[model samples]
Each structure stands twice: as C-alpha cells, then as structure tokens.
Target: MASPQIIADTEYLPTLLKLLDRAEKTIDIMEYSFAIGSATGRLNRNSAPFEIADKLIEIKESLGKKIRIRLYIEGYRETASRNMVTAEYLKEHGIEVVYGATHAKGFCIDNKFLLFGSTNLTQQSILKNHETNLLLNDKKAIAGFNKYFEFHWKGGGHGGVILPPPMIADGVFKDVLVDMIDRAEKSLNFSIYFFHISEIEKAFIRAHKRKVKITGLIHHHDAFALSYVRRTRGTAERMNDAGIKDLHYGPGTLFTHSKFLVMDNKEVMLGTGNWLHEDVEVHPQLYIHLKDPTLATNLTKHLQKTLRTVKRHRKEYTDSISI
Candidate 1:
C-alpha cells in the first residue's frame, strides 16, 4: 500500500500545479467551481489562478495530441456564465471541458497518482480557505478514483450527474459518520466549517456520555458568522454544555474550511460537504474512509497542533446560550 500524505492550506495549489506540469499521459480534473483570476489572501501571496490553468494549457499545447486533458466542472445555475467562459477558454486551448452538477474536487495524473478533498479550483478555495486534501500513490486507490473519473467522463446519469458507488454513496455519509463516532473507543476529533447538523451534535453528546474524548474546531469568521451565527454558536454551546470542553474557534489566519473526522486514530474520513443537513440532502459530495494507521496518527497530530493555535470561546451559561 502506498503511504498517504495530507496536504493542507495553500500548499494544495502549488503541489497540484507541479503535478499538472509533470503529468505524462493524462490529466483528469473534477472540481465543483472554477474561476479565472488571481488567488488572494494571506497565504497565497497574490498568486494568479491562471498560473495553474495556464500550465495545463501550456502542457496541452506543447504535447499536441499526445496528451489527454479533461476538466469536469460543476454547472451551478448562478455561475453558469463564468463556468461557460472558463470552459470555452480551456476548450480553445485543446482541453476537453464538461459541465455537470458536482461538488467533488479531485485530480488524477497519469492514472498513477490522485489528489482529492474539499478544495475547489477557485481563488478563495486555493488561496484563502483552509482546505484539506490527501495525496495517494497507491495503485488500488488511484485505480478506484480513476474508475470514478471514467464513470463521470462517460456521463453516467441524467444531466451529467456523477454518483459514487453504493459502498461510499452520498446516502451513507451521515450513517457512516454517526457509526464512526459511536464506535470510537478513545477519541473523536473533527475540524470543520458550517457544521449545523443536529444528528451529528447528538452523536457527539452520546459519545461524550460514553467517556470518549471529543474535540472540535469550528469556523468563527465574519463570513460564516454573519449567516450562521445561531447555528455555529449554538452548536458550540451545546457541545460544551455536553462536556466536550476542548471546542475552540478557528484561527484568524485560515478559514478552517476542512471537513474531516479522526476516530480513535484508527480511521480517517476526509471529504467535501460542510456537515450541514441540507448539504447531505442535496449536494453531491465525496469522501474516502481509510484505515491507515500512519495517516490517522499524522492527521491526529496535525489536528491537535491546529487546536493549540485556535482561540477557545469562554462560555458563561446564563438564562440563554450566546451566539
């Protein structure tokens, strides 16, 4: 089995670009959103989004018909024009571009390597947001994702809907998560953004009652706070009240946009989707559950280190919960 490595924050863009530059035979990209502009924010250093796009274009132009490049993008109604423009730009540059309703983000290079996670190919996602991605060199894992890519490439469902197989389908996400939490023997750690699902909160409460150590890092920026203050704050208060006292708000520098769970350092669930009830019901998300001890240990250490840097909200339970 090839060892998995976790790539987080702004590192994903540059690493992905390097892979794109080195791709020998084929490059398959699946992203939920795409924009043509520069990446901005603290970590990105004003990097241009076209830096990656242009590199792919350059490879296609230089390699001529020897290389195969296909980009599958989400066809969101609100951003149809932008997707169309980006698709046209790539199509003009010898790359095949297709639009579909997908919330999956991943890249497959030469059918030997794969990178997939919650990060989208946009300015905010690449440069500004706190994203989590896993790079795998394992042939089996690569082949599995390649199969998924091929399924979507051939247009599996109506209106270009790409569905994961039954084992890891969307319908099982909540059930799998709750089961993982329920089966935790030692610890449950999660770092997430926009976590408003009540079932997950109840799971945490139940785990706390089971004497399992639970820790969470939730997003607390103005962008999320403005729209989801009640949900975010209320969840934190409820968790704290339930005795999971290690809950902390995200650091100011990064957006804490990762959605992952580490159960007892034995299994890791990494993927897209904000753990929102509506997202589970409607959005097309993808996640992989791995039983690699090395990855679980590394991710656990990383989450603990990140938790140390975050600010914990001191709660004073009065007549009502604070938002």
Candidate 2:
C-alpha cells in the first residue's frame, strides 16, 4: 500500500489546485465552508480559493459534458446565501452542485487521488489559516473515500438528515469518541479547532484519572468574537483543572484548524466537525476512524511538533479572562 502524504501550511492550496488542474475524468468535492473570493484580512493578493473555484468553472466550460464535476456543500440556511449563489453559478455552468448539511472537507480527483482533512475550501483555510490534510495516492484509500462520497451523494438530505454510516453518524460519533477516550491504554493526543461538549471533557478527565497521558492543541481564537472565545477558554481551563495538564493553545497568527485524535499511537480519528454538541447534533459531519499505527504515529508526532511552536498557557485561570 502506498503511504499517504501529510500536507500542511502553504503547500495545501497549491497542491489542491494542481490536482484540480490535472483531473481528466471527475472531480468530487465536499466542503463545510467554501467561498469564491478572498477572505477578510487576507495578506496575499493572489487568492488560491477563488482560483480553485475559477479552475473548476474553467474545467466545466472547457470540457462541456466530457468532464463530471460535483460539489456537495453545507446548506444550513443561516449561511445559505453565499453557498446558494455559488451553487447556482456552478449549476448554470453545467457543474452538479448539491447543498446539504455537509461538513466533510475532501476531494476525489478522477478516482486516482483522495485528499481530506481539516482544511475547508475557503480563502481563510487555504491561504491564511493553519490546517492539516492527508493526500493519498493509494487506490484502496481512494476507494474508501469514493464510497463515502457516493453514499452521501445518493442518501444525504438537506439540513441534518444526511447519514453516511452508523458508526460515524450523528449522536453515534459522540459516543464513539467518548468510548475511544475511555478505552485509551497509554496516551491520548488531540488537535481540535473548537471543543465545548461536556461528555467529551469528562471522558478526557476519566482518561487522565486512569494515568493516561493526555495532550491537546486547540485554536486560540474563538471563531466569533463574542461568546465563542469565552466558551472555548472556559472549556480549556476546565480541562486543565480536571488534570489534562498538556493542553496548549495555538498562536493567533495561524489558526489551528485541525480536528483529529490519536489514541496510544495505534488508532486515529479525523473529521470535519468541532467537538461541540451542535456540530454533532445539527450539522452533517464525517468522522473517519482508522487503526493504522503508521498514520496514528505520524499524526501524533505532527501534533507534538505543532505544540512546540506555540506558548503553553500558565496553569492558572484569571478572573479577567479574554481569548
């Protein structure tokens, strides 16, 4: 089996664009958030997110019916306007665009390459944020991702009804995560964007009580400026107080937008949703659990390396807390 390659930072966007440029047969995309233009506060002028959308449009226009392009996006009405406009534009140009509560960030190119991870197809994710993705040239891995996409493409519904599989479905995923954490024998490593679920927090506390080495890396910025930061900080502090000593916050320069967990260097879980209750209950998300030791070890090492770059928060909570 060909091993999957981990791509991070600036390499992700260019690599995705190159794959899209080279695709000949089909392009399947699943994203939680996708925008056409540059994101606000973007430093670079040459935006890769817009370039990717433009590339897909160009492919559809140039190939006409020769190429097949399908995009499955999250269609919650609150954020529906932008995605709907993009969907309409793509549909008008002959691309198949389906909107649902999709939170899976991935792409399958001509059945030859599969890329999936924490990176959303947005300007912020591609150019400005810190993200991690796995690119697989292995046929077996590609087949698995293809199966997942096909299952959702046919059975998925708008809102929160799109069920990919029983193991990773809504409510089930939360149980699976808690079970995974509870069953950890040696270590638990996690890199998450947002986390507010109490069950998950209690599971980690339990693991720590069992003498399991628990470590985590979370984003410093609260997605929204209002209560999001407060909630995130509260969760982090609570976890720290509960005995998960190694939890560290990522720097504000690049958002740590990865959602993954490694248990005992033997199993790994990667997915789209934050560890929040609403994400699992109301949003369409994908969670892939694997027992590959190689992948798990690599992800664990990556997490440790990323943690080294950021400052560790003091083990003290202040009354005047601000994220």
Candidate 3:
C-alpha cells in the first residue's frame, strides 16, 4: 500500500473534514483533551470550523439509531482539563461516553479508518498547536487498534475498563524502548524533541552492539540534549570503535517537538510520546505504529530533508542529517 499523503500546516482540514463527513456507521474517539471554545486567541470562536461536540450531536439526530458514537476522555475533573460537557451532551442523544484515567489517545471510524496523532482533538491542538495524524485503511491494522480500544472500552468504568497492572504501572518507558529495539530488524531511525532516559540510552547501546543501525535526532534547545550529548558520546565512541556508522541528527529550529521512529523502513511510530525520562516514566503518552512503507517512506523523506539542514554541535549524533 502506498503511504497516505502527508498533510501539514493548514492544509489538513479539508481532507480530515471530508473523512468525517463520509462516515456511515460509527465514530469512536479517544482524546486526552477536547474543547469547543477558542483555545487560540486568534479565533473569535473555536478554531476548527466544525465543533466535534456539535458533529456528534448532528450525527445522532440525523442518523438516529443507526449511528453509534463512543467517546473516551481521560482524567477526572480538573480546572483546565478537557470538558466532559461534550460527552454529557452526546449521552442525552443516546451516545456513550467512557472516561479513562489513561493518557493514550486513538480513534476508529466505522472500524475501517483509523486516526492516530499528536493532537488531543482540543481547540488548542486543532487550531493553535502544530499536530500530525495518520489515516490507515488497512483492515488488520484497524482491527489491532480497535481491539486495544475495545479492551479499554469494556474494562473502563461505567462504559469502559481501566488497564491492569504492569500495563498501567509506572516505569514502562524502559520496557517500551526495549520493545522498539527488539522489534527493529535492520535499522532504527528515531527523532525526539527531548531524550534523557538512562535506560533508553542503554537500549540503544545494546541495539548498536547487536549491529542495528540506529540513527537519532535530538533537539538542541531541549535541556535533555545537554545530558544526552554527554551520555551518547560514549555510545558513539563505542560504535566508532566497532566500525559502526555514526548516528544522524534531523535539522530544524532549536525546537523540534516530534517523537517518531522508523524501523527497517517497514514501520513508523508517531505521536505525543517523547523520549524523555518524564514521558517514559510518568506522563501519559500515546504513539501509533504504522506498518506500511508508503506511510513510513514519506515520513522518512521528510525527516531526511530536515536532517540535511541541521548544523552539528556534537560529534556523536550527526551534526546534520537531511530527511
């Protein structure tokens, strides 16, 4: 399958809205944050043209019982948390709302189209912040994610289930990195805005020893870069000693706030998860693993272009890598 087209800046709205408008059976949304008001001051009202809240309401009314809507929002009531009113309104029309304490975000529409992205479907993310999402039409892939969704939906309280221990416990960051490294076959290409986890450092070192080609991007502006520079220097030294190739760095402003990984050109993982101790250890983070090269290759090209323009400050990670 060819990779889905890359849409960035303000160009994503039309295609995304079209997908929404074409939905026939159901819409399942798991969001970390959701809002309807102007999260960005620039907008007189909400930033996105169509309110997600309103869309659900309209679908319920027009489609009647044929439309099944499921919404999962994370966390309890907090001052600045995403509003639950959206869920409440949906319930009045017979839509179900599931509240979760987990922080990951994913959604499936009609069990065919899947969207996994960095944004939380909130006003701030859709209209104010930079965000990216993947659209997959693969049946197996959709089923895999839907299974995850169903697991949580059924296990979550009221309308869903909370995850059990180990999966829900702290310190899964190391395990996740190890899983990624274990899954890497020929190469590992990862870009992180911030990376300071000690265990993850070890995982990469271990992969390098096993002959996995590991390339990485670390933002210069992040505090973790200073620490990573110091820690990865030894890893690079070891790789150099073993005749392994040096790691490459993607180019961008001092700030590159994307966490993505491409493995063996066969899979791509993108999302809100950063390679940081905090993200790995404490923060609720989510990521989508895309197994199609069409999606992986395009993202590879973009990262390569960005990496090319970077200026090297450290000798361990490439001074510059062009995507």
Candidate 4:
C-alpha cells in the first residue's frame, strides 16, 4: 500500500475491502447515500457491499460484542433504497445507524484511521467514475475530521429536506473562491466540469481583471444537455479572454469529474459538486475548504499529469487522421 498515495478509480475497492476485513473496534461511515446492492444494479452490475449496513449487522452477530459500528447516510425518500431497513437491521443487531442530511463521504476505523475523498463507497462511484480518496493513519487528522463529523451528526445533518441557501446570498462556493483568490496573490488554479453560474465565473474574472493570474483545467466532453452546453461555452470564452490560461481537455477512464480550485499557494477547494447553477439549485452537494498546502500541491501535481495525458491522447487521434 502506498502511503501518501494516489490511486485511480478502480484501484480503491480492493484496498477498501482489505481495510474493512482488518477493522476490529469500530467503524463510522458517512456518505451522501447508501443504497443496497440491488439498487446499484440499476446503474450498473456491481455489488454495493461498502454500504456497510448489512456487513455491520453480520459483524455484530459474529463478534457478539467485540466490534462496534455506526453508519450515517443521507435520508432521501425520493429514491428507493434499503437505507431505513439497513439502519433498522443494524439497530436490531446492536449496531448504531442514523440517516439524515449527511453530505460527507468517508469512514473512520477504530477512531484511528481515516478515509476521505470524492467517493461515496457506492457501486457507480467505486466502479465507474474517476474518483480519489486518502487513507491516513494520522491521529490529529482523524481527530479533526471526526470532530467535524460529530458536530454535524448531532445537529441533524441527516435530514432529508434540503433548505436551499438564499438565491442572492453569497454561498460556500463564492466564499471558497474569494479565499483562494485573495491568498493566491499571484495565481489561481482551477479545474471543474461546469461553470454555469456567474457566481463561480465572476470570481475568476474578478481575479483576472484585478491582475491576479488565473489558470484552469476544463473538461472537453459534451455530455451535458444542449441547454447546459450553450451556457458553459459562454463562460469558457469569458474565462479565456479574461487572461485565464486553460487546459481545455482532460483524460482519464471517464470524462474529467474531479472538482478542485487552488488559489495562489494557499487555499484549496475539493468536492463532488461543480461550479454550476444546478449544483446550487437542485443538486445536493458538498465542498471542503482547506488551507492544506500538502493536499493542494498534490492536487496541482495531478492536474499537471492530466494535462500531459490529454496532450498525449489528443496527439494519438490527430496523427491517425486519414490524409
């Protein structure tokens, strides 16, 4: 196992399962959603064992009081999931499970190990998308993440009903951008799939207009609906003309899905949501704002790798064009 590792999409599942087998004392899992294996068959053909609810029940039954487990996932009734049944099963088996407004994805093991990233431990996320996660044994980091988890868990962060942040109010997206751009003092680095709302683009344009350097890595795929493509193209042009350097295409197993914004050398934002209007409107999302240079630097290195990969892939296609 690589310490301070960077594993691609398909690589994390085996490691995750190995870790689960080794877990002894306790397991705390939080994710946006935790559907049963059957539910995932609708998306694709992979078993959703990582949901952990059923496994927790088995663990309790086998260990007979040696191991403990707790689960928390978003409680959305709009979707058909075995979440409530899983929770009830775990409870009946002496394991703790709660569902509400969770927007975080990660698991804490024995209160000593931490796994956090842009993955939900779900079937599609684990098998399909380009995702990233970190497994850290650092005590301080685990303590910090666990503290934040407890704060939200106690505050009913599991509620199904979402109260949209005021449409006009400055939101977490803007707050993250402003912090990154301010400290960037020199350059801002960003990579995202969509830039539909001016709220996000305005921050970049503002940075460019103020003479702060800006660089971006954007997806080239046109998978969005026609209406969305028109708006995103407009934003792309604005970004290009605003003196923002861009890496237009990204390469990976699937289209580029990671969302990251790093400003200057200081602040960073990474999450599951795009910098788009629907992200703030209908889609439930979560973004983490941090001042961790180590993470920011590593993410920058990944972006550099993406640029190289995209260049190589593009050249292969251009060279093969029939003359």
The C-alpha lDDT values of all candidates are: 0.74, 0.75, 0.58, 0.60
Clashes of each: 0, 0, 18, 6
TM-score of each: 0.86, 0.84, 0.67, 0.72
Task: Give the per-residue lDDT digits (tens) of candidate 3, residues 1-323.
Answer: 44655543344455566666777899887766666543332222344633656666777788878878887776563512434545555577787888765455556789877766555555444654334566667665566556556665776332132233212222343465567777677787766655666566666777777788877655442344466555444544454455545554333333454567777787776766666665665555555555667777777776665556454333444335422
lDDT of 4 by residue, 1-323 (tens): 12334445677677766677678888887777555544434321236543445556666777767887777666764432655544554577787766665556777888867676667655666776656666667565566566646655675332222223211111355555655665566767766766677766777777777788666666544444557656766788777776665536453234555677776655566665666765665444555555666766776777676666666676554321110
In the predicted model 2, the residue pairs found to clash are none
Which candidate leads in TM-score? 1
For candidate 3, report its TM-score. Answer: 0.67
Question: Which residue ranges in model 4 land beyond 4 Å of their true spot?
Answer: 1-8, 35-62, 77-95, 137-144, 151-173, 209-213, 219-233, 251-253, 277-287, 315-323
Off by over 4 Å in 3: 1-12, 38-44, 77-80, 89-94, 127-130, 157-176, 179-187, 205-257, 276-291, 305-323
**Candidate 1 residue lDDT tens string, 267-293:** 988887778875677766677778877
Single out the weakest 10-residue window by summed lDDT for candidate 4.
Answer: 161-170
TM-score of 4: 0.72
Give stretches of model 2 more than 4 Å off: 38-45, 137-144, 151-155, 158-167, 222-225, 312-323
Better of 2 and 4 by lDDT: 2
lDDT of 4 at 9: 63
Residue-wise C-alpha lDDT for candidate 2, range 263-310, written one tens digit per residue:
999887777778887777776666666677898899888887776545
